[model samples]
Target: MRGGAELSRHTTTVIAGGGVSGLSLAAHLAVADHRHPVVVVDDGSHPLDDRTWASWSDRPGLLDAAASRWFERIRVHVNGRTTVIPLGRYRYRVVRGSDLRSVVRRYTDPLPHFTFHRGHVDRADQDGVVVDGDHVRARWVFDSVIGPEVPPPSEAQLGFRGWYVRSERAAFDAETPTFFDFRTSQDHGASFVYVLPFDAHHALVEHTSFTASGALEIPRVQQEALTEYLTEVVCTGGHEVEREEHAVLPLHAAQAQRRRGNVLTIGTRGGLLKASTGFGYQRIQRDSEAIAKSLRRNGHPFDLPEPSGRFRMFDAVLLDVVTRESAQLERAFGALFRYRTAEPALRFLDEATTPPQEWKLFAGMPAPVYLAAAGRRLSS
Candidate 1:
């Protein structure tokens, strides 16, 4: 990929890194019929992998259309207790990554205003983005490139490996999803098992851990734990693993909103990820819509609302507690669900809780531990 030939053309908006965020922005912009010409740049290095994104929402949009499974109840297991939390009006849904990409492409591929380019963006400045040594001047550049990740003061990474397995007989309750199972070992950070059952015979069993980001052995340990879970708890009669998935989640990391001239960051790079839980599918949707609205209404993409500081503070406090007080983690989470209920806790994590609601939710936390963590964060 060279610079000179491709530099001849320019676009009004250049969306760098055509992953979920970029694809989402382009899809929304095309759907709204934005007047500006948009170009999506990529290095064509995205691996063909199977992955699933799960989130909670009331109304379905592009994500719902591509979803393969939905659940009305989530179960949380901790301290030898099981809690089945109903999803009242909202639905817990899972969408395949392949399907999401296909759905987005279907909307943008035929649109004349959108163009997909195959190359790497060298640099983005206030003026434009440099691709293959050539410059493509644009009014605004939306960059989703995450250079290097470093966990915040909390220093916790949520690592997990999941297997899509099929059992020989009925072994799962398809209507309910295991949101968290803390029955696994918690020695290497806060460890848990998560399961999403598609049917009586098939399910995705995952082992997740919250530990230091530098812990290289976390993945292997989590995999071992997942196997133990299958043998002891899930299915003893035997099961065959069909597909495997793994991820290292940056839990509650601080993100700085940066702009290099006209380059505005989006996606994980722009602090779109929910710091505490490592969930960003819904955030991506909301952010893409905001960007599209800005472009359509204000003729610029940067005219957007600021993220909530209070929610960010809350995330920081939780991350602090998770990393600093791993032993008390189970008790802390148990109290949260026990006091706040699943829906309110989910809403709080989703950053939708108001002042009064926040107080009510906070009532369930272990008072001294969280208060100390909050004090440390505030003093810092």
Candidate 2:
């Protein structure tokens, strides 16, 4: 009923933006230490069904219950030819946003200190956050809403259009998902389609693009590509689009920003999205776990380690090629999965590879492109 100055409402932690990162952080605190008073403020944006997170994990971790599908191996396509990549330790997994929220509630809803508020975070500072008209002071404010203003001018926008569909006939392999199928048109950029099948009759078919010029693909244009892919390649029988999703994310190797003295960012705002791959679900979970551990171990979440410089360099170089050399993407991307074991490439992409592993992987790549990219990127 009053502003934060009037009532002086307070919590140990205030989370701004309850997307993947914020909720993941909340889940960590709720599960590990229930005594921490945490409030999550989320503006109701995308519906739960329209949201899904797909990533890979080599070992067990939190949100396992939230996962609806797991793939032991995945397929990749280059010019209509397919290669099934074997993931020795890693398993590709999908978590529906609704399921993740429900599972998190199983832990957080019972905790007296945990509060889920539906509101917009208007401002955040060293003292606390302003949501709507209320001010909630907190010792730590985790933000996912605001960050570097798409700066570095951003190299590209990774666009996605996904259709959650049900086919009249068997149309997919339930156990394996197509990680990347390049049979789709690449006119827009380095585009591909991936099919994550829940069963033989239902799947989430998505078209993804790396628009090198940072231009967004119109819905009608992307929709036509999806229609062609579905009609000619994916489906044998008519399918119903039960739901749909569209999104555009920036691609840039931007540094994390500290907005306020006590406020730290999470998710994209925190630079968790790898500029090269546009994948952050796994990184977000890891970051959330680290932040939670830091709070318990050091009484502050800022005790987290900085990201590796080598990984930043790798992302820069990869981002350059993905955007600057979009036409040659097949050779650059397909090489990782073709005629080689995928474990090393997977580890490299995850930034978990050792120097030796990196060298071995690099030895097979076109050195000139990478070297030139490194020179330009490292110099800049």
Evaluate model 2: give its TM-score: 0.92
Task: List the lowest-lDDT window of 10 residues for candidate 2.
Answer: 1-10
Candidate-wise lDDT, in order: 0.77, 0.80
Q: List the residue pairs that clash in candidate 1.
A: 126-261, 126-262, 252-275
Report the Cα lDDT for candidate 2. 0.80
Q: Which parts of model 1 have CA positions greater than 4 angstroms off?
A: 1-8, 146-155, 339-341
RMSD of each: 2.6, 2.4
lDDT of 1 by residue, 260-305 (tens): 5678888777767787777788899888988888888887777777
Give the TM-score (vs. native) of candidate 1.
0.91
> In candidate 2, what are the lDDT values of residues 1-380, reduced to their tens digit?
23344324547688988889988999998877847678887878745655889999898988889998888888888755888877788888989989989988888988877878777788777788788867777888999886543345565678989998888889788888888888776676777888888899988899888876547577876788888888888864788889997889887675666445888878887888887778999999999998999888888888777888898888777768766766556766676666455676788888898988777667656889889988987787
Give the per-residue Cα lDDT of candidate 2 at 122.
85
